[model samples]
Target chain A: MTENKAFCSRCGVEVEPHKATCPLCGTSIQQTEEEEPTSYVKKYPDEPAVKTEKTGRTAKQKRIFIWEVVSVTLLIPLLITLFVDLIVNKTVTWSLYPISSLILAWFLISTPLLFPNILPLLYIGETLPPAIFLLVIDKIEDGQINWFLDVGLPIEAVVAVIAAIVIIGSIKIKNKGMNIAAFILFGAGLICLGIDFIVLKHTRGTFGVSWSLYVLTSTAVIGGFLLYLHYRLMKNTKLQRKLQI
Target chain B: MNSSNFPTKKTDEESNQNHIQKAPKKDWFRLDNAATVFSFVTSTRIPCMFRFYANLKKPINVAILQQALENIIDRFPYYKVNLRNGLFWSYWETNPGMPVVIEETKYPCQKMPIRKKGIFPFRVRAYYNRISVEFHHSITDGTGALIFLKSLVGEYLTLIGVVVNDWQDVFRPNQEPHYEEYEDAFKKNYQKNLPGPPRVSKAFHLPFKLEPKGVFHLTIGIMPIKQILNKSKELDVTLTEYLVAVYLEALQDILFSLPLRKQKRLLKPIRLQVPVNLRRFFSSKTMRNFSLYVTPYIDPRLGHFSFDEILKQVYHYMRVEVSDRYISQQIARNVRGELHPLIRLTPLFIKRLFGKIIYNGQGEFLYSGVITNLGKVSLPEPLNKEVENIQFLSAQSPVTKTGCAVNSYGEKLYINFGRIIKEAHVEKLFFRKLVKDGIKVRIETN
Candidate 1:
């Protein structure tokens, strides 16, 4: 053991007996021909025990199992509807509506259950299913895509945009008390104006606004008052004391 | 509740049966001022945990250690609670489930599942001759943890037929915990109208990439206490002062060694967050977080500093900043923030978001590194003789990249560095400097 003493020429610190490489600098320690190699006893065990808690099922496994069960449950209704449609009509006819509606329902419910934490996918899940359902209904009724594009898609886009702003704004804002309510009020006003514009252009063949003007005016006043209360009055501690509820 | 509420004596069979029984319903505690922040910032990458262990002369008997843990756990009831979320703050609820002793892991301070219902905030593990306890910072500071470790070691020794007559500072298993032990010392000692400590500028951080999540690197350097003590004495400074200067000097070396352009870009002060245990200054036995930090720094942009200059700066800074007046200012600031009407009215989820922002902006971001010294550990009589050495390992910080914990047992001082980055530059420079300063260091890594 005494002959196994070795030092790293680079670091000048004595390593453990018979270590080929320095633990600090990873420099190779040269061994002498006359010295015998010695096995170093480790202070701590090298292999880590896999840290796991004993439970009946893990959270991820449970989620996956629930997703599988829901998928199978939805599959039963879809298979039954298609079988009934085939048995009734020689080819495919009115079964298209139920089939499409069931498929849309399955997509809408399953996206949130399976990928609940993914934000982008959730937004798509919220917007895409309704858009597809509207398009299918429009085609089955009029045999052309007229109201779906002009009315349904535009309204869905407006709602999605406004909802995205409110959700993302609430999450990113530092002090989330009255400011979140203000954001929602502002979003509500924007959605009203958007709906009025789209419906006027689709129905009257002219882009104009009417009743939504009254709704927008009321929401803007309330939203503006809330913003003023949050940024101005709420910041004054003396005022807060006097106005304590 | 006082000592009378706890049953002191039980038969061996009864004690064994009571090991896993439901904890009696006790009044829950609000998370201490310092602990509230730890709860917000704890994650898989930064566990916000620390470990204190004693190495025995012989290999550990697992069954005896487990029995010893089960016997003594009821004494430290404050540590046996689980973290519970509240409307405006998080509190500790007494957990009915028992905390079991398990085998030690290769990594020292892995994350504890404190957010889970019924899980305790601390764990005890045994590996070979070493018995270790890892505590979440939300539960207690080093002083509190050391007492628990001493009590556990004492009970373990007594079970294995060792007579420990000197029970000086160690809490025996049969003793009921004092009411004072459950007090939040920071709030108790907080002064109402003191000025808060000045805000610090952002210090230079290590530019190394972070390691994969859950991978922590620990390197321990064991040296003779007398040698380092003599060196500090020769320099006319305390052990902590000497070590902090060495750390700053190492950072300076790494700073100046970079390319000129990079060095210019990274010309910030090198500061270390040194935790000062408040129980020393304030008279309290609260087993929760009761410590704050004083940052001793050297601005490299001023000029190149010799080791003597660095040592003088650290010595003076620590002398002035670690006093009762200065420490009280920090406590005042923390308690005041918690007491503010706006902050108190905000919900816990909002506070958590604000905590993340503050932790990123002002927490570890303001310090280059941390060095926590538990000072010297002393156990009673024959138990001390059976214990070979004691080690303290600080938690891994993803932002700071490295942290150092120092403690001494018997003749040896163990300086353990816990890192979460792939680079070992800080550890290499620190130990190599000590070796150059005429201290013999034996290196151990995990």
Candidate 2:
């Protein structure tokens, strides 16, 4: 006599090779189309057990492709704009213009739209350490006029980049809504700005209306008005009249 | 005190329900479920000057009126018992021999200068205009209340000098159509087209309390019997349908402070809750609450629907509801969950709780308004002439509200409304419209 068949893992029913799901309970039993004969025979009546490797591979490929495409699309434009002035015009050495343009675009426009929250980090990226580096390089490099970027900009630049990573990486723990990443990014940027202000307090003043506050107020007012209009229009519609519960 | 003698009518409604060895269903006030019984005794002290309505030119003598009230008390033996379970009922005790209790107290009816709450259900009321009624929501509704009002009016008419012979012709007690039986029986008896029960969809409650400028009692008389019956034919609907359609249309125009076409659509699905009598559900008068209801929904978007269109909808729904097939199906469906033994074994408290879930949760008996057509009034043969009209106005807003009470003796229809929402010009506007449509409506105030 033939040996009794083993139950499918997902549906708890006897496996059949041709069927996609158990006839009794309708649970999907297969995750892949093909398997080795030995693995299939050993597991059940000639039917392979479900596999999860396919799903993992596809997900990894998708994420890598998206990250690559988005980074190139974003960085390429700003890099070209900055270097267009430096390398092409040959006025600034080594075309440091490309890096500075990316930083500015990321801080003001792109970061706000992509994730309005941590946008403050851009100012910190552009300031603070560069100011200190200018003093240090001036003393060390025989007080050369061009030594400012070599010292000051790098420290400010490093802190801004690290802060963005810290905020965006922390958001990985939360499986939330789409705009959540943006909110976290904006928050991190804001904190970096605060740190930069503390560092540069002696030289510069953080003015009256902060960038974050201005953006939030305008957005809220527009959204509120739109919602109010929708409410008034829908209040007396036929759909509302038909509602029983 | 125990040998029972009560009139009985054997109908399919009384079929298969007597599992308890037929020991004449216990007196309503002495039922097995006694925990829920409540009692209120109201002592009325009045100069009885309102007796003018009771006895016009040759007023009913005070001694005679008292005797008449006692006679009614004696005839309805169920009215004599205290509030008890199973056989739930309520009544006022009338006695000419006992001393009368008359004291004046202020009442809060919207506007009517001053009017005393009557001695019975009118006085010791447990009803608030909004939210919930104190009694079990399952027991009685606006429709059943309509019947009760008509009966009270009939009783009042008898107290006067007039006799009530034609009351039966004018008012016929209709048992709730037991739809459990086959269609053959229904077709044979209830020929009118009827609709299914009403379902309330949207209820817009305004926080503003009514502030009436003035209130007056005006009597609306039905056109000549021939005229109304003829118009009813031309409209191809029942007299009730035509009247409601007219009023609903009028309310659409009047309820709003401003006039706008879109505003009319806001009042769509004007639901009307009509109560059906369940007297024949079982063969026992000992039951206090024996009525069920259905609602008919009308779309107000028809703007100004023709009298015929409104009448057809109303008449058809009423017919369908009262039809044998519809009634039986409803009964079978309502009874489907309960097996015989489970119904009997279920404790009263549990039953009441279940009732709350069913009535408040599932039942949509009250429509935008309720029109309780007490059908025909049945009174003793002699009291016809002394009575001009009988009007029963259900609560208007808060509490158990909606629907106008209508009672017709012949050519006269008594229309009653709460003082809060009643517009004075409507009485005239209503009559003018009716007369224009060849249906004469007369109004009188005394």
Candidate 3:
């Protein structure tokens, strides 16, 4: 059996059958007559000439398809409600609010899903639907863009701008803390104060913050406490381990 | 049954039994000059991969293939090494165990993360009778890769009770690996006095738009080598030179067809890179990357070149550039840079930055596209009788939207055109031209 075995000319190691070159040195393998013979037959039938075409949807297209399915699912319930409201009231009375709000809600939810990669654009883009919904409601029942222009647009613009800033800042910084949550809380509080001032000024001759002061005080205390906890967590390794799964 | 569906336990135990005690100890080796450029540029989307598939006579037995893979792991230890990031250059550390064999997926050559912890640089996938190995370019050149594939196939056939002739010529299990197989041949053959190869100003690019999803498509056109050889004899050039001439002629048509203004802006000389295996030139037996490329250029500005004219020019250029001294100068330029004191001292991050710059400014831009011919693959009589066909496909990158690779087995020459672009016009043109010259081509795509 040992005499029947052949070896590689370059490496002096026994070579396997059917290899054209030595696997170790890559030299052209030398052939010899010494080998055991046995019966080996082809058992499986030949494969037909075939090619698999790439017809499946891309990842981006798949996401868009899911969005369409969700949108259609939501739209069906709103349509049923609209018919019920018409049968009861016999006029476009209560359905107007639900119809307008549902459309606004769908737009806000889908816009983020539609352009998920552009974070800043999503923050700013979500503001349009709410303002448009308000204007549409004002036109259907009464005929005024006054509420939209004075309060709706301004409030939406301020929030969208602040949200965009926070998102863009978070992406730029590597070491994120709980500062982002605190920043958003302070921004929302400031927006609320501005909203109170706007309402007071519109109804009366003077502008004064009434409801927003209490809201601001609460948010400030909570945000300050969160900042303290975040710093403590960063320093305490044992506690960090205990908090995580 | 689907290819991924296999009997798991039997295969696992057989492979574990064969390879557990004999796994080679850890070994480390430096990357050659040609391989040094690959690590910095590798990414998930654009992995440096070259793959080949063999259509067997019978359906693949995964249990036997896995066991065969484990049996032969000790023979090709250089390929079994994991890439390690060094301070100055990336290196390879011998992985302690055998690489796992997996089923083929929808995508081919999806990134192999050798740089990441505990990852291998090559993949072996089986789909029925088709077994494909996609290797990172850093480990081996085409010749070395072909040898590895042949050895794997040889082992697979033997495990299934196939009578393989000339058994000693192929890689056998339990053979101690040769130390010289890991030597950096480029460093051994480098000369200090040689001059750098001439600089290329600009190379013409294909004007087609890239595919939307960036999916690479491979089209295999199999034809009888006799017809190609006859044509080459008529043209009085080698088969590789004749094929490259046809490729250049196709690019020439695209160049001249553009409108005058667009032509002036985009029309540059077409430089076709042909990779020459250095094992033939230098006497080293190392299997790691030992190859350099020769760029044969055609200046469209000079005048319209007929097919015959292009053939003559390619033949002449290949002859001159493939010589011993000319090839040495090409290797010298790379070895000289590696030997520089400041270059050796630079950190890995800085070296990566320089690698990127060099790849963009000097590496790929010097040529329009690459066409690698592995020449011919030969197996012993009995084993070769059971095989039907073999196909090779080159990897496509951002800079190169398409590339060509050729390998011949038995009577058929498989010309694989790999492209990332949306249009298959160049591929269509290439086949149509071959048919026009009286060669029948059988086309398959994925």
What TM-score would chain B receive for each of the candidates shown?
0.94, 0.56, 0.92
Q: Rank the candidates by DockQ, best first.
A: 1, 3, 2
| DockQ (CA atoms), all models | 0.11, 0.01, 0.01
Please state the Cα-based DockQ of model 3 relative to the true two-chain complex.
Answer: 0.01
What tens-digit string does per-residue lDDT give for candidate 3 at B236-334?
A: 898889888888887888788888898888778898888888777777657688888888879998988998899889999988888888989989999
Best by DockQ: 1
lDDT of 1 by residue, B213-296 (tens): 667788888889999999999999999999999999988888898889988998999999999888778877677888898899
Q: Relative to the unseen true structure, what is the C-alpha lDDT of residue B283 in candidate 3, on a scale of 0 to 100?
A: 75
> Over 4 Å off in model 2, which ranges?
A1-245, B1-57, B81-200, B203-208, B211-223, B254-267, B279-287, B301-304, B324-366, B399-402, B422-432, B444-446
TM-scores vs. true structure, each candidate? 0.69, 0.41, 0.62
**Interface Cα RMSD of candidate 2:** 39.8
Q: What is the lDDT of residue A164 in candidate 1?
A: 89
Q: Which has the higher TM-score value, candidate number 2 or candidate number 3?
A: 3
lDDT (Cα, tens digit) per residue for candidate 2, span B1-446 = 00011132243244234222332222222122111111211111100001101112232344543343344333323223332222112222221232121221122121111112222212211111110111221123232333333343445455553454444312223322122211111222332334433345653222123322222232333446567768877877776676666655544434343346545445446665565554443333332333445565567555555555666677777766654455544444443323223332334444443443344334432345555555444334454344444333433433122345554555555554332333333343344456567664543221
